[model samples]
Each structure stands twice: as C-alpha cells, then as structure tokens.
Target: MLTARFKLDPEDRVVSFHLEGHAGDAVKGENIICAAASAIAQTAIGSLQDIARIEPDYQAEDGLICCRVSYDGDDQDQLIQIASLMGSVRIGCMQLEDSYGSHYITCIDES
Candidate 1:
C-alpha cells in the first residue's frame, strides 16, 4: 500500500505534496491523473518547489496502477478545479481519501 501526504492551507490556495513509493514509471491510464495532480499542485503553489518528492511502488494488479499522492495548498476549490476536468481527463481511477484534515489522492486502477 502506497501513501502520500498533502499539506495545504484552505484559505490561501497553496499546495505542497509528497509521494511515497516509486512513482517514476507511467502506467497506461494513470498518466492524465498523475499529470493533473502534479499540475494542480504546481498551479496551487505557483511553483514546483512545494512538491517535496515522489516515490513509486510495484504491485501485482492487472490493468491497474495504484499510488498515493500528497499535496498541500489553499482549499478543495483548487483541487476541484482540476477534478472538474475529470470528464475530459483520459486516465485511470483517481480516488481521494480524507483524513485528519488532510487529503490523499490515490490511483486505484488503470486501463
């Protein structure tokens, strides 16, 4: 199980993220989500410096890519801005889990 940590300020619309495991590889349907997630964080923070790091993990799941992404920024609004484009996003399953005032977006499956 991979995990990500996102530290964000709801009022400021800024973001930073840390990805756990090995995330350098690109799966079939995860590119868009991964790119969108990265873009959102980049846009929210207005720079890539806030992106702490990324790690990837390998698992035995056929036709699916799973990973955790952590980020910090102003609010869900920024996230929603990217999420709203989900329809136009050609990618995998982006799942978000909320805990302890923080949110994590995980890719569950891919094509």
Candidate 2:
C-alpha cells in the first residue's frame, strides 16, 4: 500500500499532503486530498449536509498537492471533528490553538 503525509492547518485552511510509494500526479493526488477534505467537511457539516466548497487551485510538488480548504463556521468543535475524521483517511498530526485561532493538522497515509 502507498503511504502519504499531510500537514493541515484548519485556521489557515491550508494543507500539504505528500504521497509516496507510487502515488503520482495531480489527478491521483486530487482523489486523496478530496477524500480527506470531504471526510472533514462531512463531519463538520454534520446533519446539515452542507457541502464545503473546495477551490480548484492547488500546487503540486514532488507528488504532493498543497491544497486549501475554505469554510465558514462558528464552532471550533466542528472543526476539530473534521480534523479527527481526516485521521481515518490518513495518520494525522494535528495542532490547534483556539486562543490564536490557529489549527494545524498533519496526516501521513498508513496503509
């Protein structure tokens, strides 16, 4: 199984996901990114079933896609839930500072 590493910052709405072991290109990378993002968004949106809009713009570097997630919500718990759900998609290193309004989450694919 292929492994990937991702660093996420929910407050900044940015993530850097690194793919390894044969994962390649923007097309394939998009799937993984979207999957993780969708899981997070799904959790955050909850029963509301609101879809978070993902911007098309992304940066690809050495099989990594630096993507951004944009969503506006009032609850921090919801964001944490989203980050946690992403952990299911990939092993994540998450950092959050409510005082500073900063959330950083990193995920590495473990298959």
What candidate 1 gets wrong by more than 4 Å, as runs, is 8-16, 20-30, 47-111
Model 2: per-residue lDDT, tens digit, 6-110?
Answer: 555634332434433322224654645334544433343342233323332344444333333333567666555444444433332222111112122223432
Where is model 2 more than 4 Å wrong at Cα? Answer: 1-3, 10-72, 92-111
lDDT of each: 0.33, 0.37
| lDDT of model 1, residue 44 | 33
State in Å the error of residue 80, model 2. Answer: 1.9
The number of the candidate with the highest TM-score is 2
lDDT of 1 by residue, 53-102 (tens): 22222222323222222334556654454333231121211332222112
TM-score of 2: 0.31
Q: Locate the minimum summed-lDDT window of 10 residues in model 2.
A: 95-104
Error of 1 at 108 (Å): 15
| lDDT for position 30 in model 2 | 62
